[model samples]
Target: MNFLQFFVWGAWLISLGGYMGRNLHFEGGQIGAIFATMGIASLIMPGLIGIIADKWINAERLLGICHLLGASFLFYASTLTGYDEMYWAMLLNLMVYMPTLSLANTVSYNALENNRFDIVKDFPPIRVWGTIGFICAMWAVDLTGFKHSSAQLYVSSISALFLGIYSFTLPKCPPAKSENKTLLSSFGLDALVLFKRRKMAIFFFFSMLLGAALQITNSYGDLFLSSFKEIPQYADSFGVKHSVILLSISQMSETLFILAIPFFLRRFGIKQVMLISMIAWVFRFGLFGVGNPGEGLPLLILSMIVYGMAFDFFNISGSLFVEMETTPQIRASAQGLFFMMTNGLGAIMGGYASGAVVDFFSKYAIVSGQSQLISRDWHSIWLIFAAYALTIAIFFTFAFNYKNGLKTVKEK
Candidate 1:
């Protein structure tokens, strides 16, 4: 159920930008705003929800209820037309969905630890299935042609509905308050103090910057590939018709690359690993700037392959770094802080900014009665994003300095 929950998101998240642009006729800024809701909701609501689940409610029950509510909102969202209506519904849905990510992890880790499983060895295989689930959902959407239809929303809703009900069947996870009498310490906010450390501060700041880049492409890449449908010869091309499936190559690569993280980080150190991530982002965006979905499909494929390094290198390695460096007492809170900087503030800003940039590129297409036309300068917009990623790479290469060393803690 946990894996399927994220699978539904992976299926459509990257492709929706394209659908909105090519099929729904939304403005760029508006589309970005829709994606921004995820970050916005995560920023404000997840912690509060965590508090409720920890203190007063059964975590499993809360998880199930949240998903039921989220599924309904998503179903309602599919019925709406226009950016305004869609944005409101998505914001509501995200509020319900965002916290589940954390809750699911909590439930899984608690279950594994309680059962005395060898988490380090066993958990990787279990987690890898989540990637499999994501790939399966993406393939389903592409195969069914739901990537261009409102039915994709239904796919996610139905999955959420199933998971919501099934969550109740999981081993009971009671409120932690019964074990710990310290109510004041349960609030989980004190880790915010980590911002005081200079290195941690820099690490987190860059995290937000990179986080901004994370969803921008997801928001627009499919749309870019689909835009080729406008070119007559490429309209029925396989790449255009099955862009979501092709893009799943990135997720597949992600599965392989995550395994390489320990080796790469051990060999190169955090600074270089992060630098590679930034450089890969440059290529990831630049490939889209120059390639077409038809003859240039190889470039797109290469871009997807590199996506593993670009995404996993920084995010997973960075998290491990935080885990290694933080004091144990505040570790959980610090992790939340890390997420806040990256996925919360960074995502919200990135989502909105990417939209604005896309809209800027499409400025030539003034609103006609019912449709928007493409600008001759479409490629220019992609190049601009590529340039931004490159600039970040250059700055990171020079500005950050950390010794190259893999410091792994041996398991007992």
Candidate 2:
């Protein structure tokens, strides 16, 4: 079930940018806007859904129904031809799907705690399968040639449908009683109380900044590579021809990097770990700006290599820091709020902003016979993103007050 949970996302997340640009021929900004729909939905709905699942419904049942609804919306999205239609469909799909991310974590934690499992020891092996499932789905899309089609949506939708059904069979998690029946508690916004801590406040603010970078590459990198088809030499290149396979390197790196998190967090501490992530982002965007699929493929490959550290370092370590630093009673809510800042508000801002940048750069290009833009200043766009990362890194170093630069972890 965990495998399929991520399988649905892996089938489509990275390739959707290419599909929107290459297949639907939508404006880059509009495509970013479409991706932003997920963030926007996440910002609004996850807390509310969490409240519902906590108060009145079973987590497993709620999980099932959410997937069912999400599947229907995803299938509906695949049928749409334009950005306007797709935007609404995707928004509905994400509203249902976003909460599942948190819900899945909740379900897993609940089950592990109930069974008295050593989550720190056992969960990693099981969670590794989620990465395997993600890789499998990416490979499936590449092999089946669905990476650039509406069929990717169908693939994801079908997976979600099956997972939804499977979730019903998981251990039952029932609603909890609450003494306070106020609006905040009902909506699961009580987690907002964490903002009272200065350290957490700074941590969450940067999380939003980093989250802004998360979807930028996902929303445009494929289209960026595919855009090279405008140039004759790269038009038939293997990397261009098999963009999905090439893109899979990012996910591949993610899997490996996830395994290294505990060590890195222990050795370097959260500040340094997050700093490495910030530095990696500069390469992530700079490589995209400078590399092509042909002669520059090495740089492209390196960019994908850095993606693991760039992504996993910040997300996993940040979550762990939150888990360790915050009190146990509000850990779930703290995590939820962390997600809202990063994936929710930050993602929405990034998607829309990146789209605008891509669209702006695209306008200067001259399109020839094939849908390729000639000699456009894409380097500037990448450099701008690199600058953004650098700026964020600088601010974080100076502003986020962590006294000890490193900490050693004693494994139990």
Candidate 3:
């Protein structure tokens, strides 16, 4: 269940920008808007759907239904050639797709708890398979030439469909028989009260910032590698030719970090674990700024390797934190709210803002008597991203009070 869940995303999430830019002639802004579709759907859907899972529907069944519905949208999106059409199609797809992320977690948690497993320890090992699934999909898309074509969407659609069917075979996660009494509590809107606490508020606020940081690379990483084809010195390099496959190293690194989560969370706790993730993002972006696919390839490799820490430490850890903090009745909604800030609002800010940044440093140039769009200031772009992550890390250090903070949070 977890593997196919991420596999559906991995097929198109990393390489779609390359396709849009290379084939459809999309500007950075246009492409960013398209990517921002995930944010839009994420912002709107996760919380609402979470409420449904909490109150009415079985989470596993909802997960299945969502993937099945989303598969059709993915198929339709693949047929689109225009930016507006594609954007709307993707938005619709994500409306169904984004909620599945939290739902998948909820279903997994339910199954684990029923089986008497420790969620914190066991979930990461299971989640690592999702990362492995993502790596496999990235390799599949890259090697099959789907990385630069709409075929990636077909790949995603097929995966979603298969996962949808397979989900029914998993244990059902029906609505928890809860004691939430008021209408608001019953609807799961009480998850919003988490924002009232100072520490939780600070955490969510930074999650939004980091979430914004996460989207920048996802929007441009593959295309960044593909851009090297324009340069005579590195045109034939393997990174340029198989950028998606190369970027899969990042996902490959995720497997190790995912496995390490149990020890890290137990040893360092959430604040420190998340802080490490923030610091890692700094290196993740900084290395990218200074590296290339050749002699600098090692730096790129370093960036990819650090990506595991950057992504898993915060994202996986954050989800686990929410699962630990909340009661079962509202757990799905809490997960939804956490990701809503991360993927939804954070994604929106990252998509549009990073697009502007890329555009700011980029311009069209006449090269070899041809009008070509050149993005040569990637060093500045990645450095700017690194600086942003660094700033977030610094502020987060001072802002979050972890000692005795969890006590206060639980009391509230």
Candidate 4:
């Protein structure tokens, strides 16, 4: 379950920008707009779906249905050659696909609790396999020459199809029993009350801020690496020829970092751990700004290694924090809210903002009568992003005030 779930995403997520910019000739803003569909769908879908999972049906079953529907969208998206059609298709796909993330977590959590295992301690090891799966898919796309082709969507579609069908066989996760049974509670609108608490409200606001950093690399990392090929001296470099694999080093780093989450969370607590992630993001982009495909390759490698901590500490640990902070009856909905802030609002901010920044630093050039993507000041762009991350980290340090070790929700 964990493996295939991320394998589907890994097949396309990291390489989509390269395909759009290189083959489709999309402008930076258009590419960012398309990626923002994840944010749009996230805003509109996850919480509502969480309501359904919490009240109407089994989470595992809904997860299956969503994946099946998402499979169809993925296949259709591959057939699209225009920006508008592709955008809408991906939006619909994200509408269904985004919800599955939370649903998968709900199922995994339920299964673990039923088995008497500690989620914080046990979940990371299981989730580590998901990162391994993601790395494998990235390698598959890169090695098979699909990194800039529509076929990557096909690969994702088939995997989603399989995971969709296979999901039904997982253990049943029925709706939690509810005594209130009111319309508002049934709709999971109750999750919004977390905002009324000063600490949680601050935490979620920061989640939105950090969330903005999450997809920047996924949107442009490979595109940035491949851009080096335009230079005559670096044309034959391995980083340019197999940029996706080089970028997969981030996911490979994720696998190792995820396993270390339990220790970090236990020792540093959520606030300090998240602070560490914020600082790592600064390094992640700063190193990207200074490195290249040639003699500077080790710096690029260091950036990739830093990605593991930047991503996992905030993402995996953040979800576990949500689990610790919400009541069992509302846990699924709370999880939805957590991601809606991060992946939803956060994604929208990152996508469009990153796009506008790229556009600011780049322009088009005509080469051989084709308007090719060129003249991008990638070094400047990455540095600007690093500065943005550093700014956010500084503010987060002052804004969010949690003391660290996981605690049960203190319902005020």
Candidate 5:
């Protein structure tokens, strides 16, 4: 279930921007707008579905329904030629798809608990397979020459359909029955109370800022690699031709770094671990700015490797921090809030902001007395992003108040 969950995403998530740019001729802002749909959906749907699952529906059944509907939307999206049409189609798809992420986790946790398996000890290994599945999907798409084509969407669609059917076969996770059934409580809005605490409010604010960094690569990394094709010397380069496969190295690194998290957290604590992640993001973007496919291949590889640290450190660690801080009654909702802040608000802001940045750096030419946007200065763009990440790291170091110690966050 975990494998298929991310496999569907991996098929097209990294490559979609390239397809939209090359095939559909979408501008940077338009592409960003399209990706922003995930943020918009993340904002609205996850909380709503969490409420539904908490009070009314079985999670597994809801998961199945979401995927089935998402598969239909993916199919429709593949057929779209216009940016506006594809935007709406992808929006619909994400609206259904995003909730499945949380639902899958719920299903996994419930099943693990029911079988008396230790979730903290056992769940990480199972979750690692999802990253592996994602890597496999990216490889499949790149090797099959589907990365710049609509065929990637078909791959995702078929996988979503299969997962939708398979979800029903998972263990039943019934809604939790509670005696105090106020409207807010019924909808899981009780988690909003966490903002009343100053520390939590501050934590969530930073989560949104860091979350902005997360999807920049997802939205533009492949397109940036493929852009090298515009240079004659790099036209046939391995990285240019197989951008998705090369990018999958990031996900490969993620699996490794995930194993390192407990040690990092135990030794350095959340503050240092997250600070390390912020520093890694600076390297992630800086390396990309300086590296190319030919002599700089090693730097590109290093960038991919660092991406593991950049992603898992803040994202996974932050989730764990939320888990440790919140009470059990609002635990699920708190998790939802963390996701909302990062993937929802953060992604939305990042999408539009990055798009504007790309557009700003794009060069224009007067061709036959008609102004035309000719090329993007990718190096400058990456450097700017690197600078942005560096600024975030600096601010985070001074702003967030937490001390380093193994005793603080380690599970007893």
Candidate 6:
């Protein structure tokens, strides 16, 4: 269930930029706008569907419905040529697809609990397969030469359809009962009360901030590698020829890092683990800023390895934190809220901000008359991202407070 959930995403998420820029002739900002659809849907759909799963619908059923609908949209999107048409198609696609992320977790957790399994211990290994699925999709796309073509969308669409059908076969997860009957409560907006707590508020704030970094690499990392094809000396480089495969290293690293989360959380606590994640982001981007396909290939490989720590530490640990902190009645809603802050608002900020930065660097090169055909300064763009991550880490070190061990919260 988890594997196919991310396989659909992996097929197109990272490679779409290359296709958009190389084949569709999209500008940096337009590409960012396209990616922002996920953010927009993240902001709206997850919470709404989470509310449904919490009070009215079965999570597994909702997950199936969302994916089925998303598959249709993705299929239609594959046929689009115009930016406006593709944008709206993807927007609709994401609206249905984003919520399934939370729903999948809800279903999985409920199933695990029913089987008397420990989530913290068992879930990571199970979830690690999702990353493996992602890697498989990326490799499939690259090997088939679909990375720079619209074929990637078809790959995603088929996977979505498959997962949509498979979702209905999972164990049933009925809505949790809630006593209160109100409009806001029905929509699960009652979880908004989490903002009233100082600790929860601060954690969500940083979640949003750190979330901004989540998609930056996905948005441009492949494009960055493929851009080397324009340079004479590096035109034939393996990194340029198989950019999607190269970037899949990060996903491979994620599989490993996901397994390390339990130890990190127990030993260092959430704060330190997250702090380490933030610092790792600095290296993730810093290495990209200086690395190339030749002698600097090692730096790029290192960056990909570090990406595991940077991503898993915050995302997995944060999800576990939400699970351990919130009441069972609001558990799904709280998880949706975490997704909203990170992938929703944070993603929007990162998309536009990073796009603007890319455009600015490109404009600078044109203004300086370096060459009309010269591409944007990727080195500067990556360094700026590294600096942003560093600043967030420094502030997060002092701003969020928690102890050095996992504090148990009794499940209701």
Instruction: Give a tens-digit lDDT track for model 4, residues 1-412.
Output: 9999999999999999999888888778888889989999888887678778877799999999999999999999999878899999999999999888878988999999999999988997887778788888999999999999999999999999999999999999999767344444433456889999888888888899889889999999988988888889889999888999999998888878877987887777787788899999999999999999999999999999999999999998888888887888878667767877898899999999999999999988877765566679999999999999999989888877776475423332
lDDT of each residue in 283-343, candidate 6, tens digit only? 9999999999877889999999999999989998898788887888787668767877898
Query: Model 3 Cα displacement at 39 (Å)?
Result: 1.9
lDDT of 3 by residue, 1-412 (tens): 8899999999999999989887776777888888888989877787678778877889999999999999999999999988889999999999999889878988999999999999988997897788788888999999898999999999999999999999888898998759344444533466888888787788888989999988777889988888888888899898888999889898888777877887877677778899999999999999989999888999999999999999989998788677776778777667767877888889998999888888788887766754457555889989999999999999999998775333344466
Question: What lDDT, from 0 to 1, does candidate 4 have?
Answer: 0.88
Compare candidates 1 and 2 on lDDT and give the better one.
2
Most lDDT-accurate candidate: 5
Question: Least lDDT summed over 10 consecutive residues: which range in candidate 2?
Answer: 403-412
Count of backbone clashes, every candidate in sequence: 1, 1, 0, 1, 0, 0
Model 2 over residues 1-412: C-alpha lDDT tens digits? 6799889888888899889887877777888999998789877888788778877898889999999998999899999887789989988988998888768877888899899999888887878788888888988887898988999999999999999999999998887666334556444367678778888788989999999999988888777887788889999997887887898899889988988887887677888999999999999999988899889999999999999999999998888778777676677667777888889889998988888777677753435523443344678888888999999999999989885533532231
Pairs in steric clash, model 5: none
Give the clash total for candidate 2.
1
What are the Cα lDDT values of the candidates? 0.81, 0.84, 0.86, 0.88, 0.89, 0.86
Q: Each model's TM-score? A: 0.94, 0.91, 0.87, 0.88, 0.93, 0.88
Error of 1 at 122 (Å): 1.6
Candidate 3 Cα errors over 4 Å, as ranges: 54-56, 109-124, 172-189, 262-269, 317-335, 365-376, 403-412
Model 1 segments beyond 4 Å from truth?
178-189, 364-371, 408-412
Q: Candidate 6: lDDT over CA atoms?
A: 0.86
Q: Which of 2 and 6 is ahead in TM-score?
A: 2
TM-score of 6: 0.88
Q: What lDDT is reached at residue 178 by model 4?
A: 78
